[model samples]
Target: MIKKLLLTFSFLAVSMLLAQKNNDQQTVDEASEKLRLAMISGDKTVLESLILPELTYGHSGGHIDDAKEFVEKLVSKKSNFLTIENTNQSIQIVDKTAIVRNHLFAQTHDFGKEQGEVSLDILYVWQKTKNGWKLLARQAVKAEKKK
Candidate 1:
């Protein structure tokens, strides 16, 4: 009887852990989708909504920008892209923060008429804040480019 109870408790504990992990995964997914849409649409407001006030972005342009600068550039019509693809995304949660790693494929228009596909390795750090999951920092590096 005691053995059976122990086994049941263990099973329940494992089940609960799995459920929490899945829930956390979903949260990250939603945030990522929001980010992708914001980038493609050049909607800095949406992107800023997900970002923490302390946000920092290390762009592929060999420069870094703070939350304000990042939003301004995105909304200024200076950078235009037709598509943004998030591929092979993985998230790791540690306490109140999560790190999402993924690759992005992008195709841009005009702006020197640059048309090609580029692969970028990206890292997004999110913090669980009073509001909700907020993007703390995002850093991306160019892995490859095909012209």
Candidate 2:
């Protein structure tokens, strides 16, 4: 009888751990989707909520922008995203940080009316903080177009 109870307790403990991990994964996934929508809509409030103050955002073209510069460009119509579509994505969490890999296709209208597009591979690092998950850094590499 004691052996059965021990086994049951062990199973319950494992089940609880799995549930918690799954819940955390769901939270990060939802946050990522919100980020995509916010970028497409140029929503500063949502963007501020998602990105850390010390964010390092790098572009495929070799430019790197700190949080203030990045946000300012987005808010001022210097950077305008018309669409953001993810071709594939994966997120892995370790302790308080999550690493994300995404293959993305995007369209933009920048500098008021200059149009642009990109297919890129992006790596994002997210840190879990008191306010929730905030993007700490991102690096993007433009992919070669398929014929």
Instruction: Please report the candidate that would top lDDT against the real structure.
Output: 2
What is the TM-score of each predicted model, taking all chains together?
A: 0.83, 0.90
In the range 1-147, model 2's lDDT, one tens digit per residue, is 999999999999999988877877888888989988988777789889999999999999999999988888888878888888876788888988999898888888887587988889999999999988899999999896523
Computed on alpha carbons, the lDDT of every model, listed in order, comes to 0.82, 0.88
**Candidate 1 residue-wise lDDT, 1-147, digit = tens:** 999999999999999988887788789789888878887787877977899879988887779888888777667745666788888899998877989999898886635555756679999999887776888989989886533
TM-score of 1: 0.83
Candidate 2, pairs of clashing residues: none
- What stretches of model 2 exceed 4 Å from their correct place? none
